[model samples]
Target: MSDAPREIEALIEMMAKLPGLGPRSARRAVLHLIKKRGLLMNPLAEAMQAVAQTARECLNCGNISTGDVCPICTSEKRANGELCVVEDVADLWAMERSNVFKGRYHVLGGTLSALDAVGPDELRIPKLIDRVTSEGITEVILALNATIDGQTTAHYIADQLDGRVNVTSLAQGVPIGGELDYLDDGTITAALRARKSL
Candidate 1:
């Protein structure tokens, strides 16, 4: 049992549930918060509370938002003919960080998983199809991860929108600075298949 009080122990346990945080790390974080209660803990708590109260899914694209629509969905400048489809909000945020894709986004929330019984209805796939027609999207870019389930989901989406719109996918191969010797068999195969002529 921990020597800390019940409240502090509870806090540590709660923090331990966060991604990438173990019990020991949570304990250290809790202790740090206690040490900087006035300067850090109060603001952190306030911010968490604000987010908890205001956070909601965007009605249009399934992105997280405080209002019915996310800023990206509402912005007129993002209304290009291209629509990028991602597996989650984190993927959408990553794309935004790159600043390469100027068009709007559609978050599918997760990939299809037959083992887990997740299907098209479980994701935002239907909404994606509706948006393709309603928003006058000319191109649908599948930005899913290069996993089995991600590939399955991408294929399903492509088949669904086969004749309706042009479909494309993010290229999968080697990283920018990655060494060929360090890459695995799959990476080498994919890179060889996607090889470009100089």
Candidate 2:
């Protein structure tokens, strides 16, 4: 009875599976996009297609990039002898939003989990150590989440880099098991500024 097609409904269903969207919101979004197809939807679809085709992880620091090495990893200016380690790319982006740290980042992809059989090798730990040596890193900051897994990963990294470079972790008030992505930018800056050594 309706003009809307089944293909359009399928797109909405797929969009609803995304993190925050539900069926109601997805339906509304799809309708809105269809209404503004010429102005918004076409460009959005092209951009998504481009990213989907080109996105790849940086071989060095594990940051997402279209190129072999991410911009940060290749930038001479960003080679400030400081390395910020994060559990996820989202966490790295949150730290970048704060603009507090002037160094490159090493994304771990995920934390070490004994329960899930995740180990140091599964993460970018070995690569991080290599960067410390080759990049002449003076400080290694752990901006991991405050969860048990995050802390455990932090300690493991600290131990790995012990006596090699200054190892520090984001200070108190991170909220137990709080994620960097969920924190306000100001809170992230404060936590980074007040970070203490391991």
- List per-prediction Cα lDDT, in the order shown: 0.97, 0.91
TM-score winner: 1
* Among all candidates shown, the one with the greatest lDDT: 1
lDDT digits (tens) for residues 123-197 of candidate 1? 999999999999999999999999999999999999999999999999988999999889999988998999999
What is the TM-score of each predicted model, taking all chains together? 0.98, 0.83
The residue-level lDDT of candidate 1 at 103 comes to 98
Candidate 1 total steric clashes? 0
Predict model 1's lDDT versus the native: 0.97
Model 2 gets an lDDT of: 0.91
